[model samples]
Target: MPEALLLVLMAVLGAAVILVLGLVAFRAAGDRSALAPPMPAAYRDDATGAWRRGTLRFVDDRLALKGSGGLAAGPWMRGNLDLGIARPLAAAEAATLGRSNLIQVPATYGTSTFELALDEQHYTALRAWVEAVPPGWNSQVA
Candidate 1:
């Protein structure tokens, strides 16, 4: 019985170590994401026209929306999994909905026009990213 107890203790310790290492690696990967940090926001669904809570991420030159809650609330969790909407920076245009900080992105083919409510700071960051100057400006000059 003592030997069995020792084995279980060892197994638990090994699992804890693995979990810590995995969390560290995941955090490092999340730090590598480009643009702004993940922003907590809700998006209007295309089919149902209902809002779903999620975190918005900009990585690898694309913007992705991942569902919120659960492990995603942790800092180590990048919230990159189960992306709902992933589109290139230039694919969609963002505009203010009204006096509020709400932003509306008109949908393109096969997509629906949706709105994302953001605070002032995040709204500015997202707007700047969407309306940034195009690359290869000098090359365009003949």
Candidate 2:
């Protein structure tokens, strides 16, 4: 009788532990889901130019590009271009004058990072502009 009671107690404790673990797991998943959805692969604008928006989450040696948008899900590239192309002339100026290339533009809501390459002529200009941009400038939407 004592042995049976011991076994029952052990079983009850095991079940309680399992239940607690399951609840913890569920809570963690819910928290992760609460984070904003990843950015989208491409965003089409009425103005012009190709744009790509996504998150660059770094984990150790690997980086994740999470695309956003509802209906159509996009691919996750190793190195995602979070920012789309700027307007033609704007892009040209950014490229010609800015040497570093306009990988990401400062925005109000979020930082706009790009994957496009720029010409050497724009290198100096691009570098200067990028350097001048205030930190957190990308957090603004406009």
Candidate 3:
């Protein structure tokens, strides 16, 4: 009985180690220089099809999300913003969603289409930062 219990514990510990390593690798996968500082936002969780709390940061032309929901919150992942051909929905149009702070951003990968909810104060800054990316820089796929 003791041996069986030990085996179960070992299995649980192994799983945790794997998860941590995965998160670390995911977080380190992208270009460090192009990474902008992270800001708090809510991202749609691809795994569970639910909205989860996370940090959103721009990694070059891509947006990466690092979830804070828990171990099961999933890995740090990035999606192409496809800014070359797409822009964030107009603020006025987005405001029609009934949440003034909601911003719908289109992407080509990861969570392809996601909504990010930001406070009124931070909304303007985020939108400006995204729009200011040089148009020429967005021509190439990230």
The clash tally of candidate 2 reads 29
Taking all chains together, each candidate's TM-score versus the true structure is: 0.52, 0.26, 0.42
Choose 2 or 3, whichever is better by TM-score: 3
Tell me the RMSD of model 1 versus the true structure: 9.4
- Please state every model's RMSD to the true fold in angstroms: 9.4, 15.1, 8.2
For model 1, state the Cα shift of residue 78 in Å.
19
Q: Candidate 1's residue-wise lDDT over 113-132, tens digit each?
A: 44554555665565565545
Off by over 4 Å in 3: 1-35, 45-49, 69-111, 137-142
- Best-fitting candidate, scored by lDDT: 3
Candidate 3 RMSD to the correct structure: 8.2
Backbone N/Cα/C clashes per model? 0, 29, 0
Q: Which pairs clash in the backbone of model 3?
A: none
Query: Which window of 10 residues has the lowest lDDT sum in candidate 3?
Result: 71-80
- Model 3, global lDDT: 0.54
